[model samples]
Target: MKSDERMRLMDLLHVLKKRYATKAYDATRRIPEETVNQLLEALRYSPSSVNAQPWHFIVADDEAGRQRVAKATPDIGSLAYNRPKVLQASHVVVLCARNELPESYLTEVLDKEQQDGRYVDSTARDGFAAARAGYVKQHLDAGDVMFWNQKQVYIAQGFLLLAAGLLGVDATPIEGFLPEALSEEFGLEEKGLTPLVMVSLGYHADSDANARLPKSRLARDVVFSKA
Candidate 1:
């Protein structure tokens, strides 16, 4: 690259680095709805087990809904850590995963694939389709899907956090809330959703002190390798 191009790139990188200063926000700044939708849309494309896309989210923007979430959080972290600032933020996206998928849909989709002319033998196709359905049913009954779904949820969470930062919105990833509390309050069981993470989104306060704190990291020797 040319010298001028390299210098320009470095300047842009510095701007990005300075943007994410760990700032704590107050209640005054509100996150826009368009920003929230774009961030969540990024998560919708996240990879999932079998493309099941098991994750779900509950957008908490109303005062009553935020209060319910605040009440459910366990008071164990640093006082500043679990601040209701999240509740006051423009929105709190409660991430979760669906506990179950309808077996009928699974069977029907598989059966349709068998009829899509991918196989040469009609009789053999019936046998193969039946076996696949049985296999899927056995795993679904064994209850190991949650283990796989949890990985997808984390992927979505990572995407959401980065998208928020890229959009110039301040977001905090919170996991201190009681999942069961949220599940019950929202009646998530009926929707087949289980709570996983809470992400609060909004603009940061101009005078918040967290931005001034030094960023910390483990030594490079402990984290990276060139070989």
Candidate 2:
């Protein structure tokens, strides 16, 4: 491998090694708006099955919005552990997946593709949309469209984590919150969205106990298999 390419690979591995699920955040310190916007952009470009981007993000940067999300984290349950993280993080992102695909949304995606010069002719545009529609239909027929969409949302979450790491920001992907309560809290149902997961972003407090813990993972041989 080329020296520069090898160094780039090492850099990515280093970033992955350094990142962890931050347990505590420095509430007084906030990630700059510009940096946060870049992180959101990273999520925007995340890949989805058949180019059907069926996800939305709610950025709770304001105190009111954060507090609203915090309400979904009950004080006496499995989700209770994430309450303080929600309240104290500089910002929280509510990742939502579409429950159903409306025709308008399909049209909008195709229209954007045309606008972006993805198709050279009307036939090309229609052909591409038809191919994507077939993929959508298979999921719809199986009554698992929402499940497929949720999988795509997680791809965006992975992108968010990597982007946050590259920006030197601390982040924690949260799945413990109440989905029903969060949906109501954010009025997601009205928008045809279901809250699937959330991620809190901020700088970690110096005394964060999780920060001091060593990282652990399964053995490489156990996780990988040769075809």
Candidate 3:
């Protein structure tokens, strides 16, 4: 690789190395409006299986909005530990997965794909649609369609965390909340969405011990294999 390309590769890895799941957030700090918008745009561009885009994110930035989100986090058990992060973080995003994929949503995505020139012509669009539909059917027949969709959502979350880290933002990916409570609080079921995970974004507080800790991971030998 060129020297510039090698430098960029190192820089990106450095960001991942330095970033940690924030344990505490400085409530006084806020991500600017422009940066927040950019983050959401990056999230939308996250790829999925057959481009299903089977996720919706609800963002809470203001106190009232965060408070509403906090109501869904139970005060008992380990979930209570995440409640403060939900409320004190500059923003919290509840990542939702579609409960079911209906024909209407598929049509909607296909329409946008066509409108954006994703296919060269009608024949290509039709071929692409058939290929996507076959994959959807395979998941449906296996009774794991939701799981399949949530896998795509998780991929998007990975993208979001990396993008946030590159922007010098702290984040905490939370999975301890009660999904039922969140769904009810947000009336997500009415919109055909099910809560899957949440992520808090902000600057880290001095009290965040995790931010000061070193990152530990398996050795490259254990994590990779040559084909």
Candidate 4:
């Protein structure tokens, strides 16, 4: 590879190695509007099963909104530890999963795909639609449609974290909350949405101990093997 390409690859690897789940955020430090928009765009292109795109994000960029999202996490146990992260972060994004995948939704997505030149021919479009339907049906039959939808949302969350890393922002993926409370707090049921997970984004506070800890992972030999 060329020197520039090798340097680019090394830069990305360094970002991955340096990242950590920030435990505290400097409430005063905010990500720029342009950078935040870029992160949102990264989420918009996150990969999903057949590009189903069964997710929505509730971004709290202000104190009032963050307070509302923080309602689900009470002051108790390990969950309380994350409450401050939400309230103090520059922004908090609540990733939600669609409660159900209706045929109409899939049809709408496929129509847009055709408009965007996603298919070379009508047959290709039809086959893509059929495959998406088949996978949705299989999940429904197994009684795990919501679970599967939530998984897609998780995949998108990974994209957000990666983008945050490359942008030199601190991030923390949070799950220590009452799911039912979160759904009710956001009135997601009425909107056909269910809360899956939340991620806090900002610069790490001086008190953020996790930011100072060394990166830890299993040995490459133990985690990866030739197939």
lDDT of 2 by residue, 88-123 (tens): 999999999999877789989999989999999999
The ten-residue window of minimal lDDT in model 4 covers: 72-81
lDDT of 1 by residue, 1-227 (tens): 99999997886565455555334666876677787779879887777655556678887787776777776665555444565655667777888986765766555555665567656777776676667556556757887767666778988988887777678877788876677878888888888888888888787776767666555668989999898
- Candidate 4 residue lDDT tens string, 54-161: 998999999999999888888787678889989999999999999889999999999999999999999999998999999999999999988899999999999999
Runs in model 1 lying further than 4 Å from the true structure:
1-23, 74-83, 104-143
lDDT for 216 in candidate 4 is: 93
Residue 191 miss distance in model 4 (angstroms): 2.4
Task: Give RMSD to native, each candidate.
Answer: 5.6, 1.2, 1.1, 1.5
TM-score of 2: 0.96
Global Cα lDDT for candidate 2: 0.92
What are the lDDT figures for the candidates, one per model?
0.72, 0.92, 0.91, 0.92
Judge candidate 4 against the unseen true structure and give its global Cα lDDT, from 0 to 1. Answer: 0.92
Candidate ranking under TM-score, highest first, comes to 3, 2, 4, 1
* lDDT tens digits, residue span 1-227, model 3: 99999999999999989999999999999999988987888789999989999999999989998998888787787679999999899999989999778889999999999999898999999998899999999999999988998898999899989999999999999998888888888899999988888999999999999988899999999999999
